[model samples]
Target chain A: MMDFGSFLAMGGYAAYVWPAYGAALVILLAIWIDGSRRRRAVDQALHRLEQQRNSER
Target chain B: MHRFANPGRFLRLANRIQPWLKALTVLGFIIGLYLALWGSPPDYQQGETVRIMYVHVPAAWMALFAYLLVGLASASSLIWRHPLADVAAEAMSPVGAAFTLIALITGSLWGKPMWGTYWVWDARLTSFLLLFFLYLGHMALLGAFDDRARGQRSAAVLAIVGLVNLPVIKFSVDWWNTLHQPASIVRMGGISIDSSMQWPLFAMAITFHLFMLAAVIERMRTLLLEARLRNQRLAAFERVGTQARASE
Candidate 1:
């Protein structure tokens, strides 16, 4: 097994490999977070509208 | 398929499938990353830089696959006027654009180490750049009009017209002597990749596919809800207007 340091070094191309993976992680996380936030906001708006209709009736 | 054209039924179906998709995507990423970083061996030519392929290749595949989906959705929206098709196209474009950006950035990172430069104006690179712009154009057209339906119709037309670029992006490497390497996995002769690399690549690809599906489904659900909100507000306004006129 390679040492932790060597593995992190990525065969001396650390700069290139790490950033590639990092960008993937950041972008994927952004998609998930933004999706969840939008869904929640819209769902809340819908729920409020339903309640308002019920109260008026 | 026609039955799913109803937004309510589609939303219920999406709700059922989303949990499973999210779970599988998370699991896939775990296994995929482990295999990519540890289990896979370094390339003889590219060395550890080969690791970048695991992410780059999958993102590129999704970028293309998602565009193909947008093209199909746009066609249905235009032809059959499938109610959900417009939502599908609109929701998927941003996700597709995100993947394209990832691919471009990661490809650039890989190129610097392997190809000895950050970028080159090769056919493959240039065409892929055009794909990114096509996605941006699609999204821009979606909001360009005051009438939401008109905006959607214009975006759909752009997506359908952009279908020509899909073939160009796929064939760019073969059609020109580009610095970017040609197909290794999907070529006619056979798969050039070894079993060691294949596992991680397939794992990541599947994960990305599931992620795309889940993201698009979530976006569609939110869009449907927003549409309902709009209609309700409009109805409420008309009701108040009728009461005022009735009193007068």
Candidate 2:
């Protein structure tokens, strides 16, 4: 098994390395989550509109 | 391109491709991160810090690539008036900005260890910052007008004009004496980096590209749906208004 301690250490550059990866992960996650939420909201609105139209018919 | 110009057709195609793209992105990230973190040997000179290049370089590349797509889409929208091109360009702006932001942040993180400073007024770095602003400018211009067409047109113009910054960013290291290193992978002669490092970098770059594609397509679908919803509501309101008038 790889030594978890040294991996975290990243040969003494952990402070720089970990934060770089972390920031990227967080930003990507935010974008993905925001997009998915927006899509769901729009989809729901469309479905409601379709249902209303059907009922009116 | 013409066939896909229809938003419905485009959305259908996008939906089909999205799941595959998502899978590829996930697989690439897994392999790339594994290789970058442990599989590859540390650089002889920079040691493990060299690993930062995998993330930093790919983000930088995607930033430029996304802007290029925006500029090209803008060109098509302006010239041919392709129906989907404007939406494509608008959808790409925030994604491009996010990549640019990532690039700048990661570049700073890398710089702190290698260059002894988080930032310097280097040409490459400065031009990249300008590219980020250009993206924001494009996005803001899009919302500036009451008329959506006018907003899109103005943003398209900005995107085309911003093309000048791409070459400037690419050539800045060569043109000026700067802390940022000159091109290594892409150059006149050949790639300078070792193969051990190259594989992980390529994997991460591909992953970022796939991720960007999936994100843009998702955003476009949402935007198209929102536009449709707006139109539906307007039509419903108009119908109700006409009925009330007839009843009166």
- Give the number of the best model, judged by lDDT: 1
Instruction: Name the candidate that leads on DockQ.
Output: 1
lDDT for B136 in candidate 2 is 97
Off by over 4 Å in 2: none
Candidate 1, residues B141-248: lDDT per residue as tens digits? 998999999999999999999999999988899899999888888678878788899999999999999899999999999899889889988998898899899999
The DockQ for candidate 1, computed on C-alphas, is 0.87
Q: List the residue pairs that clash in candidate 2.
A: none
DockQ each candidate and list the results: 0.87, 0.86
The C-alpha local distance difference test score for the whole of candidate 2 amounts to: 0.92
Q: For candidate 2, lDDT tens digit of each residue in B1-65?
A: 57888999998998899899999889989998988888888899888889888999999999999
What CAPRI-style quality would you assign to candidate 1? Answer: high
TM-score per candidate: 0.97, 0.97
- Measured by C-alpha RMSD in angstroms, how accurate is candidate 1? 1.1
In candidate 1, stretches whose alpha carbon ends up further than 4 angstroms from where it belongs are none
